[model samples]
Target: MLLLSACGGSSGNAGGSGGSSDDVLSLALENTLPGWDWRKQISAGHVGLEWRPVYDTLLRTRTDGTVVPNAAEKYSYNEDKTVLTLKMRAGMKFTDGAPVDARAAKFSLEGFRDGGGADSLRLAGVKVHVVDDLTLTLTLPAPNPALISYLGGSCGQLVSPASLDSPTLATKPIGSGPYVLNTRATVTGSKFVFNRNPDYWNPDDFPYDKVEFLVMADETAQLNALSTGQIDGAEISLGSIERAKSTGLRVDSFPNVWSGLFFLDRAGTKIPALGDVRVRKAINMVFDRSAIAEGIWNGNGVANSQTYGPISPAFQKDLVDHYPYDIKAAQRLMKEAGYADGFSITLPEVDHYNDEYSAIAVQQLAKLNIRAEVVSVPRQESISRILGGEFPMFVYKMPVNPEAEQVSNVLGPKGAFNPYHSEDPELNKLLAKWTVADGDQAAKVYQEINRFLVEKAWFAPFGNPDLPWAFNGSTTISGTLGTTPPLYAFK
Candidate 1:
């Protein structure tokens, strides 16, 4: 899951040709580029939008969430599925003229694994070997079924080996991608400019000759830019849907993220109530998901209890209402858990997200006799604070990735969202089985995992919220499996 942050910046008319020009594509991003280091890159949310055009991954994920070949022509796994060998496409070179060969792939992969990035754990206990100039193999300690899919995301983005040790690597990017960063025209926090790579290996993939990202942290500014023909498209809040449509802009909405409260301290190291399954289930049943979704999201989201979206293989329609809104039942559970008097807990909030969710949570949880305190934290420090185990539970949003990736992010023993490192023996067993399972067996295991999480009340997921994007009709933008559409997906 990407820890989103908000920062104020001025939106300018830099490279804003609107959607009238077919050669240039302009869009507004909620956040500026965090950095250019692909190793520390996040492949969801607005951050992914900033660096996607400048780096090419070994594999690619289609709009339908299928993994396919990109820089690598083909890939195969060993009989035991512990080793993955990739064959690189011939003649591909980075913008700096370094050959994008097996050695470069090895360096990039190893660097990412040891870089301590957010997604580094995906490659933990993995070793890379260069077989030749065009062939490389990744040896894994155990079979990871999601490894291929991860390669299509940030974890697989390849950087030039020549620039690996460059001091300016964080601020500047050097890769074999569709576009090159126009450093002269880019204003660090305001706007970013990219020009087509003349020597790009796959020129036909990207139709636009130039791509520009204007930093518009405020949604109102993004809407104004879209209405004034200053930008082609922008990811907007659900509340702006009607306003955007009234202005004659095309609105594209899809389920991309699930937002709700994360019960991080299941072990109850700080709050003993969270350790009891009954207390967690009682908390889950107290909130009306339908009311929250319609009232807060303006009827733009679906009310579901599971973290997996409709498209995920693990998504079970029957689990949508696993815990219905029943105040009496919740109180009964709370009383049964010997917490009839309730307990106090603090929830951290960020400015970028709507405060209404947490406010409603506090109100609903109060009915169940739980005193929830909402604490506002700085956007920059919110993620660190949560991961540091400062809060037992908190309201947040996260992208709905594939089943395997979702498990690795939220349910795994070392999951990013599992800040307290809470462990369940049964969940650990299912996760181990999922790593080596394939085909029908894999789907079954995934569903079992989802059922286990929901039944155990590990989280109180409100629903899968629609990610809305407003744009002009000059060019078409396709929906992606991420918060924002990729630049190459626009035509």
Candidate 2:
């Protein structure tokens, strides 16, 4: 899920090669939150650590956006384009050594579908079919070109039967992934010790002996520890990139699949300002995304033009380019919408997005004669309020997905994330066509969708930012060419 799959086709035999248990590795991260359950919601911060030794999937996209096989050894598409048959590798076992057969994969797929959670919408139209122990097929209600791509998303990560052995796999998970969870309790808010699986299917290439994840909120605290050698690497805040570089540490910045915005509550009736489409467009034009990307972000980020989509090639074509910065256009739209004198709206800020970005957004809105009230709150409280439809327009972050299906799930009018209730009939028609086209044809359709979103000013894209970091001298960092994906494999 971290941009690409590091997995390869099976060489021959499957299972562990008997490595020493002393080879434990440790990693450090800046923040943490309560949603560790992969089945519940979409949170990138959790997936960075939680994904390592916990979940497995059928295919993975590398930093270059190339798909690679993970759990499935061989796969084939049917003539009708409705069934996806995958042949599982033999001799593979879970952490508990329970047989990771086709049935287990089928159960994981079916469990997610019937879970009836927000994530269920991603799998709603698909049906799982078990052909045999080594082979399984995914049957879609219609011809879905995004099926294989969906298999590479966070939602497609395979879960083990042992994960269900306990009632709370959210915190204490048991998986067959490359790493295994070694800690049982939270240090600050869920800390884990990740040891390279001796039984991991591919042990030769996974260089890290062990990995550790500490979930703390303060980015400055993370940087402070990295300076003192308490942590090796951390995500630097937008304002701290140059300072991190000044310390002679290695800085890695990439365009992450994360975007922040003020989501208007479409279901709410009280806030009349949000009902107007021009108001949203005005909001998009107000913020100088380029300035935010250059000054505050230290050239580490990009201005995102489209709100509810991924930055990857899989979904990028469906995204509209840059948002118009002309304040006159914004003013015209506002006046035509009958808010010529400007109006005030309150926005509750969620901490997951950059705080500076939210404050700047409020200032930008003021330029368009629109007053925005900023209310800072904890991440969980903000999410609860937003989900309950309390705020008219509130700050939120949408994590990037490398697949197009994830986009459909978030942006499609009737899809799960219909928060704005964007009922663009043309977009709906294109999405339907996109869901069933071949890879090449899908890309073309997405290109049209992208142009449409841009023309409508659906969501502004701030440029992708660089993610800075410092690592041990032994670490080797390389960037894949002509792509904006974020994935790294330690050698």
Return the clash pairs for model 1, or none: none
Worst 10 residues of 1 by lDDT: 1-10
* Cα shift from native, residue 422, model 1 (Å): 2.5
Model 1 over residues 368-468: C-alpha lDDT tens digits?
77898888886545655776679898888877766666677677776666768889999989988998888889889989998998999998899988888
For candidate 2, give the lDDT of residue 415.
Answer: 50
lDDT of 2 at 261: 60
Q: Which is the leading candidate under TM-score?
A: 1
